[model samples]
Target: MLLTFAILLTTAVLLVSLSRRLGLGSVLGYLVGGALIGPAGLRLVTDVHDIAEFSELGVVMLLFLIGLEVRPRRLWVLRRAVFGLGSAQVAATGVAIAAILAAGGLAWPAATVLGAGLALSSTAIVLPMLAERDLLGAPAGRTAFAVLLFQDLAFVPLVAAVPLLAMGPSSHGLPTEVPWREVGLGCAVIAAILLGGRFLVRPVFRAIGGARTPEVFTALALLVVIGTATLASLAGLSTSLGAFLAGVLLSDSEYRHEIKSTIEPFEGLLLGLFFLSVGMAANLGLAVAEPGFFALALLGMIATKTLVAFLLARLAGQPDASALRVALSLCQGSEFSFVLFAAAVGVGALDQEAADRATLVIALSMAATPLLFAASERLVIPRLGRERPRVFDRIEDDGAPVIICGFGRVGQIVGRVLRMRGIAFTALEKDPAQLDVVRRFGEGVYYGDPTRHDLLRAAGAERARVLVVALDDMEEVLQVVDIARRNFPNLKLVVRARNRRHAYLLMDRGVGDLVRDTFHSSLRLSELVLRDLGIPEAEAGRAVALFRDYDERRLVESHAFYTDEKQLIQSNAQAAEELTELFAADQRRLESEAAARSRVGAGD
Candidate 1:
């Protein structure tokens, strides 16, 4: 048993690491690793059935964490996207696929089940993929999340309807009639969970917390998740759905962060295991046997789903680029399809051969998604670039003293201050949406990419006394800085560094007048915090100033070896220890001075 476990962990770590290194993502790595170690490959882990059941808890916990993030009010805020757009996408995609299957000589009942299953995209896959790229907050990412959430809610009824959709109960000997008793039980259990969560869970948490035992609190947290999931499972409900409800109930609780921290490790490991198990369960033999049919089905599914989702997004008033993103991100089949298909087979709704084929197709689609997304990012998005709503605004060469490269949050401030001083300046913003907002405020910011050499010259960069590179994108900022340095050598550069790395790059280009955008504000905030904590205002100011000076010096010193991880780590550690000693010595000197003053006063 331990050996099997060891092999699984070793394969997971090695493959997942390699995948991430290659920028393919950890989910795909897990799938590939599972495929390599499963019965079809090395024959090391043959009993996938047991492993699958255990790994399913990962899905439950993941949904729970998602629920914690989505408070009821926040869910309300996304009502339109969640219901309007989400429902539309599912219904359209499901019906379209179902119709195609029915036309392919399959029964309406079975085709409908397959279509619904295929229509649902993998929340597990999509969410992590979006988050890895830091796009979860973008319009398309948010839209994808809403659709996934709705699918989760929809999964319950879909699974329940499998038995109802059964033509005859041959294998399990199930009844064809509506299972009212089970339906009532599921509803009652749901109500119990909701009421208990509102009335009982928090108080129990309080008691456990009052006992001041962290281990006990952690156990209680796990118990809540497992217990609710078990209840839901017994009532023939999706365990993940139950866990999600529990998480949503506690979303507004003070202990939400603590609970999330406690459960995250368990969730991550199990989730990886779940994906691993899925890879192992994949029937590669069947796929290889009918490669042509498999390829056709896979392509058909992806194209159909993508087209349906894209059209829906466009109808919902999303911009073309964002609509494309939404479509591409969610074109794959869901993990829940495996469960739904298995249930369908048990109830004799779908044949075993059909389920196996669908499962492999779904898995392959999931495997293909990262590649598809990469193509979108690398090939498609650049061409579509901000949807290119209008041509670049022509610049009138007023030969203003200042040319602000980006009129974003930072550039707008510089422009505003210049305007207040009656100083003429030219501002350029690439995002049309942003430009529109600025225009509403009567700001004279032109919509143009500042990195364009022609646009820079048109903005009178050569004539302007100063050039401000306050663009959000660091690459753009550097480009503008370089343009100014090369073409307009006399122009004073005031650049914004998004982070330390960016600051280093700017420094490398011989621009010293750059600001680490958040550094000063962070220091000021820290000073305020120290004063609030009962430190004297002067003392707080001194502490902040001392740290600031030390950090600035370290930033310059570390810039030489910033690319070397070991040297950077060592430098940071040494700087921290030295700062601690400096603060200690300063404290001692203040105490000594206070003592001397007391002695002098006593003498007087």
Candidate 2:
């Protein structure tokens, strides 16, 4: 039976749109759509395995983007948790779960596989939720990252553990899928990737950096990720691990943001596909056959897992409320549980009957996670009855020289800098508690959603000469920009972009002074001047100002192309080839200017 690609494409798009409209995660949409057209459902999308293989490019892109940020220096900050907290969580959870299963009359091998499989929380689902909720700048975000970091590190051991556990006491005629040669080779290859990447990846990037074409860099980054994953697959290792390693390799590159920009669209599409595939693969008949038993199992798993996770996080010093939040967030099982269970059943480890039971529980738990997150934030947090830190959204304007949209770390820094310079500024913060702290120091920050058309006028948008988009939520930042630009078109709109996509979006909206939130541009300016020459500090300052102006001009000009995405991509191909040629010519001009300056300095 053959299916048209057009139908598959339409299903994917329809599922995604429906999910977003319903305020559900795209993951659910993809899975539901996949199930409908799957062999068991409509039977129209049986050849979806090929689609799965292609959609995996999204994961490769995801990892590549992560790698661009993995500098060795940053690891020092997380070294304590990454090794101590992370290791403890994986080891304790895996062994404890394994022991429980073994006591329940399961083979040690099968139990171990199940435990390791269950330990992983979904990385794909958590980050965006945190960022969207404005929790990324909080203590919980740091703790979440520490736990997620540990979970990512656990992948290697779990992959290795699966095979060993499957060979339990009874030689139950289970055909071993992992050949000795492949396992041994995979372990060796993992070592090679870690060791070789540190030395080789940086130099490779330097040679390519001057190329400056987004596509070439995107292609190269994807190759590294996919190639590593292919090797891991060949060696009987987890491909996701290979993808994660690809991210660690480029964790410190100059064009990191650009790399991120190239990967985002692909990641969104494939991640959606992966979710859809999960849905299509679910056995609805099994779910329906024993609804009561399945419901109990789902509750039991979610409850047990959430309790253990909460206790672990609390022991690590998070407050009880924060611990509970963490617990609810991770109660869900992930897509890979299917992969792990399939292997267990194929081998003589788990009986098909037991595997089906576990599969039903995993699916229900995943479906319940988003609901749990929403409930915790809306119901649980407010009920805890802890007083919020502060409220400052009611401050009156007094002809403040600057206006800030958010009172987060970056906004605070800007406000403090301006204050020291004897410049008055009015800030707006939606988080009442956060602004309460700023109020004590006589800082003025009003609370209101800037997206409201009237809120901009109330915030003195007409009088304020400068408007700063300091909000962490990219979507909210855009809304603020749109409102501010429309009402006060002459206002200076300085913005903090979450990443390249955010930056590009802002550029399209006529923002001339957009700064990468994660990247310290002022520091980068100094670093760039030092790299080019040890020019005097004052001279370096002037050059940076010139370069900043030039970059802003380029961003403004590029807005026309970016607004029309199709044209932007079409132009990217041609622009990529010419960048090297253009860069060389610019270098010659810079060199001549440097020489002329040298001659003048000598005369002086």
**Looking at model 1, which ten-residue stretch has the lowest summed lDDT?**
382-391
How well does candidate 1 score on lDDT at residue 264?
A: 92
Q: lDDT per residue, candidate 2, 451-526, as tens digits? A: 6666667777888899988998776787788667656887999999998667887776677787887555665667
TM-score of each: 0.65, 0.64
lDDT of 1: 0.89
Off by over 4 Å in 2: 1-23, 67-70, 166-184, 343-347, 386-435, 439-604
Please give, for residues 1-604, the per-residue lDDT of candidate 1 as tens digits.
7887898899999999998888788888999999999988888898888888999999899999998878898899999999999899889999999999999999888899999999999988898888777667688889999999999999999998888887555566865477889889999999999999999998898888768799999999999899899999999898989999999998866567668878999999999999999899999998889999999999999999999999999998888888988999899999999889989999888998999999999999988898788678777887886542256899998989999988889999999899899999999998878999999999988888898789989999878899899999765676677667757899999899999988987887799998999999999999999999999999999999989998999899999999789989998899889999999999999899999999999999
Question: What C-alpha lDDT, on a 0 to 100 scale, does residue 478 get in candidate 2?
Answer: 75
Assess candidate 2 and give its lDDT.
0.70
Name the candidate that leads on lDDT.
Answer: 1
- Alpha carbon lDDT at 387, candidate 2: 38
Q: Residue 423, candidate 2: how far off, in angstroms?
A: 7.6
Q: Give the Å shift of residue 80 in candidate 2.
A: 4.0
